[model samples]
Target: MKDTGWIAATEFVRHPSMVGSAFPASARMVRRMLAPLDWSNIKTLVEYGPGSGRFTFEMLRRMRPDAQLIAIETSQAFVAKLREQCDDPRLVVVEGSARDVRRHIAAETCGRADCILTGLPFSTLGDAEADIIMHETALALKPTAVLAAYQMRTAIGPLIDRNFAQVRRDFEWCNIPPCHLYWATGPFKAPKTARLHLISSR
Candidate 1:
């Protein structure tokens, strides 16, 4: 893959348009975000909004050859572009929104996802839409699954806190705009739930 060319194309890729360039996450960033996932415990991994196969490629590089990778994307052009770049047997590129993750992976009794990586432009989504995505995310994850998302907006931390347990800020200086990474596990529990209520719903 011509890494330089791919990054350049992200500038004009259409579909769910955003100001930030598609600028795929760097190898270092991918490693850092996925560092918490125990490789030995993972079998099926899902990448939400894998634009241009940046993080997808990194996942391919790290996982075992037999591990299944399901990439859910909304852009047809990006889906096509990603298909062209990804020819690995372990990877499965599905052209659709992250909201459809449950439907796509439901048939596989053995394909329970252990980790979910999201790059959706959450800041642009309305509360309802974001809620649906979060709801689906919770359903798609296993009992101990982890959700790692990148938000360019610092104020989006509360949104993450609402849907996830053990929510914590992970990274913010990796990208050009310095994204804030939100890391959480499964769903919020009792103690955290009460604390969650204490947080101002700004």
Candidate 2:
């Protein structure tokens, strides 16, 4: 999509809770966070809080031509901007809360998602809400579906661990606050590791 960085930054100031970061994630950071996914196997991708299509367009570029992407955003301004800027037949920008992702995913793909990309700030959310999103997200996805996410805080790791069995922790130091990144799968199963912290640097 066109450069929506400035628009994204402005939105963050107006809606910090919803936008999560002041800057649209660095291209490098987004690349590292998404590199683990096997793009060939991803037919249905769901993105939680795709602010201004940074990750949305990238995923679209990498996913199969016939695949679909459903992006759930709470901010109407962000949603409008995405809808206005992107015309790819593979993209679906929904103006709604990430908490209701299951409904959105079901409507778009009519099945469980192959992957879910999280961009929401769990640290800023209520305990109950964060727990619900994680649990429901696990249920909305295939048992072995991937949950690739990036956060400016580490608190979300344990919450994700509760629902996903295999969790791998990593970090990218090139972003706004030098955030934490995670790749989790094997939903609704016992976690093999409490936390595997690779903790890499830029």
Candidate 3:
């Protein structure tokens, strides 16, 4: 198991009532999700619900010096903590809900994003709220943009169908409880029906 420091940090940052864990993706997985991205064409990247800035820090590290990173987090405590933790001028930490993706980006970054890394737990969201957030996400994305979301839930067909042209599951069995990562492209046709392998732990 990874050290408890990371564990504690995540828990401290995530909303107390939130069902999802604050655990950040392993560095390897993070790199893989971002590898296909053409960094040269990417001037801005937005991260939704960046708990403790795990992926936020990583994105900052990998982006070109001219590139900027915007992390939209709703928790006030997490936002204050992150503000203290990160000092990079290229990084902008916004303490607000990602549901307002377009306004948040337009006000802070002043441009549409080339890549978006989301860590929200859609499984907990109501259908109406989910639809609104998803729609806003599409509006915020550049035509060629990619949105990579990490979900611990195996059943993401609804999300995949509603928002993506294609859905690829990059499974990491080594992680605790394991996880199913999703990569999606904007303006995708919703699938009629889809099946996925659901794993149950003893």
The 10-residue segment with the lowest total lDDT in model 2: 193-202
70-186 in candidate 1: lDDT tens per residue?
898776666777788768987888877788788877744354578788877777766667767776777687878788887666545665666676776777576755677777785
Off by over 4 Å in 1: 1-20, 107-111, 188-202
- Candidate 2: lDDT over CA atoms? 0.85
Q: Pick the candidate with the highest lDDT.
A: 2
lDDT of 2 by residue, 75-108 (tens): 8778888999889999999989888988988787
Clashes of 3: 0
TM-score of each: 0.81, 0.89, 0.80
Q: Backbone clashes per model, in order? A: 0, 0, 0
Largest TM-score belongs to which candidate?
2
lDDT per residue as tens, model 3, 26-120:
76666676776677877889998877666788788788899988898876666777788879998999988778888888887676888888867
Q: lDDT for each of the candidates?
A: 0.71, 0.85, 0.71
